[model samples]
Target: MQLHHSIGGTGFPILCLHGHPGSGGCMSVFSEHLSQRFRTIAPDLRGYGKSRVSGTFEMSDHLLDLESLLDRLGIDRTLVLGWSLGGILAMELALRSPWRVTGLILVATAARPRGSHPPISWQDNLFTGLAGVVNWVKPGCRWNIDTLGRRSLFRYLLGRQSPEAYRYIAREATPAYLRTSPTATRALRQALRAGYDRLGELETLTCPALVLAGERDRHITAASSRETAGRLPNAEFYCYPDTAHLLPWEISDRIRADIDRWLDAHPEVLRP
Candidate 1:
């Protein structure tokens, strides 16, 4: 599928990938922040946003879609920044085609399945169920933004994502979820939950990796992120106190600065 995307700024390219039930639009805030110093491209995966897909698909299909996108854009290789599920995709891409990735920035993600982290608490599960219902009932409904961002829920997801972040979910992620076929989302989620392990493979990733997480992240604990970083040959792990799973959106400024430092250390990848 020819996935739809948004590209801006000018410099070394950084492809930003969003999490499940969301599109490239979810990363709009982060992309805008980095666009001033780096070229940022965010693509809506197949079956989300303006992208099109047929039948069931897995991570392999998503990886191929990205490769095809880079090929069409005449980009041989570029920096990849992925959030949540997108982080998994980033690692997979770098693992499968190390030559095509210059560097990796993984935000609020784990190296394995959700079970690798501490078990989610009942409170977190409540919000998770609420989100699922909202997505199923009116994934594109802008009106449900307030309820989804209710203080209690937001507190669990993150100390609290910014209003802009909430709005992005209302305007972008929600619609993208609605646009995606249920069957497709189910297949992708199932695959992600199938205990996919890549700890042994992380050592093979030649590209430098920066793993960012929140100390308060209920979805993927800081321990999980640290474990993932430890497995990588060249990886650095950073955890923000009081932060949560919405690291990409909640801490864009910090992330951009960190990326700058990471890029400086790995100047080899800056060559577009």
Candidate 2:
């Protein structure tokens, strides 16, 4: 795996993991705030953005990569804040390496995958098979700012931002694989099918956790966040009312404030 990352800040290490279909740069909105109080590290997960994957991709591949990243950084223990797909990965990392994870902040994610089936539908499957023809016939139909803007998933995740701001960010943040690679697309579909059901495993998490969700999230329902928090012995759940799936971008300051209070109350978790 070839990983791309950005490291900043000065205190206890806090690793920020971006969601699917985006790169480490997605965290640009919150990096400055987090940097004021932490040694922040944000990385594009494999197969997304500039990260390169050499073999078959699995959810576990991401877990292992994150573990190696921390090891390479010489970070003994760190607080992890993950959004969407990244949130699910953060939970897995904490479960698999309790000692390495000091605490966890899961936003806009669930303990299980959003849908019962894979990431693709029958239409999508057919489209994938005829991708070459479709590309030839309609070169710009697959991915464009307009197409992305119309996606319910995008709306659900982004909530309500200025149209111009949303368009600007989308243009810069959207990944190339979202339009090109069948392999990356297939990996997401397959991984979601496998799901992130770890309710039973939550009992084993020694570190404190904060589960956050947007009240208006159309993708992962707020109920899922509640369910996730209830399963963890040391977890608290918070919902940002009227917000959408992109809680970090939609309401970064509020999220940061909550995190500050949560950390202050649980200082033991921050000690090296």
Candidate 3:
């Protein structure tokens, strides 16, 4: 499938991948921030955002879509920034095509998921679904119930997230979940729950990588990300205190600066 994508700035490319229950637009903040220094390409996955897929699709299809998207865009080599499920894809991409990945920025993700994250309740799901539909049908029109539902769901999933963080967290997330395929979301959640392990394969990636995790992330544990960094030959890991699954939004400025430092450190990848 030709995945719908959002692009910004111009320089070395950075493919920004969003997580499950999310769209390319979900990563817009991160992409836009990095765009000033590097070209950022954010693509909505097959079952998310504008690239919706009906019926059923496998996780392998997601991987294939990324490779094909790169091919379509004529991106031979680039940096990759992934969040949650997107981070898993980033690791897989670096492992499968080492020559194509110059560096990796992994956030709120793990090599082997603990599957301890909480699930949204049926009530919350109903609220989210409705809010999503409303947000999509009428742009910039949000109701009190919509904000309540979105924030409630986010809080539940990100139990460790700080109250102050919500200022930036729910800004784009509410819309990303809009028009998402429930079937695809459920399948992806099941896969994560089933355990996707790739620790042993990390040593093979030669690209410079920066792994980040929130100290309080309920979704993917910080220990897992740290372990992933340990397994990689050349990788740096950072854990932000008072943070949760939405690390990008919670610690936007800090993370962006760190990303800039990491990229600039490797002039070969940063130079236009």
Question: What C-alpha lDDT values do all the predictions have?
Answer: 0.78, 0.72, 0.78
In model 1, the number of clashes is: 0
* TM-score, one value per model: 0.83, 0.80, 0.84
- Model 2, runs deviating above 4 Å: 115-154, 161-168, 175-181
Residue clash pairs of candidate 2 = 157-246
lDDT for each residue of candidate 2 in 82-161, tens digit (9 for 90 to 100): 88887888888888888888898888888864532226456544544353233334443435324433332344445654
Instruction: Give the Å error, residue 110, model 1.
Output: 1.7
Kindly list the per-residue Cα lDDT of model 3 for residues 1-272, writing each as its tens digit: 99999989998899999987788888876888888877889999998889978788778788899999999999999889999999999998888888888888899888886534666678777765665455445533435333653455655455344433443334566656666798777778777668778999888987788898888777788888888889988888899987778777766788888887877787765433
Per-residue error at 243 for model 3, in Å? 0.6
Local accuracy of candidate 1 as per-residue lDDT tens digits, 46-91: 7777787767776788899999999998888899998888898999
Candidate 1 similarity to native, TM-score = 0.83
Give the Å shift of residue 4 in candidate 3. Answer: 0.4
By summed lDDT, which 10 consecutive residues of candidate 3 come out lowest? 159-168
